[model samples]
Target: MYYAILAYHEEAAVESWTKEEDAALMTELLEINDRLVHEKSLGPAARLGSTQRAVTLRGKGAGMITDGPFAETKEQLLGFYVVDFPTLEAAVEAARDLRRVNPTAVYEIRPISLYVPGTPLTARDED
Candidate 1:
């Protein structure tokens, strides 16, 4: 089965990291990512951009588009990973590995009921 691992962290705290600090952490994470790739346990993963540039569309009809993430929680969704694991324990283990490297972040794991590999993202307008 495939699982979605959503990564969350305090946006402000993450933003405060020095370039070298961030790069070092990413390098470590990428190392683990590479191992998972070789094991064929990893699928697509992405590092989300800052919330300052985010937008939310609400409602079922002509949804209102608003600037920035509006969640009032302390942590913000920072990134995500899609991986195939045989059991929930296996998925949790993968998340644990990620947490070990980035102690401050939180990982939310959920079984994916439906997923489509969607077309490669192309053209977008810049305002």
Candidate 2:
């Protein structure tokens, strides 16, 4: 099964960290990523750009175009990882490991559903 790990953190708090602190955190994250890579469970992973560059589109018919994210939450989505694991327990364990490295961030794990072209959406299952 494939799980999507969503990372959320306070942008302001991250930006306020000292250069050395930031570097140390990055180093730890790199080490964790290396381990995931070696285990062959890591798929695609990336840190998103600042929310300032984000655009929100809502409604129908041309939609109302707006700048920035849709919500003004204290914590914003900062990054994500797609990991393949045999069981939900394994996926949750992976998320827990990531939480150890990035103590300040919250991780959300969700299973990915397979999408097939030209097939009814209702026909798809976790398989």
Which structure among the candidates has the greatest lDDT? 1
What is the alpha-carbon lDDT of model 1 when measured against the actual structure?
Answer: 0.90
**How high is the CA lDDT of each candidate model?**
0.90, 0.85
Question: How many backbone overlaps does candidate 2 show?
Answer: 0
In model 1, the Cα lDDT at residue 35 comes to: 86
Residues 1-127 of candidate 1 have per-residue lDDT tens digits of: 7889999999999999999999999999999899899989999999999999999899888999999878879999999999988888999999999999999999999887534568564443222
Poorest 10 consecutive residues by lDDT, candidate 1: 118-127
Candidate 1: stretches off by over 4 Å: 117-127
Highest-scoring model, TM-score? 1
TM-score of candidate 2 relative to the true fold? 0.84
Candidate 1 C-alpha error for residue 60, in Å: 4.4
Candidate 2 per-residue lDDT over residues 57-112, each given as its tens digit:
99899999899886667899989988888988898898898889778899889988
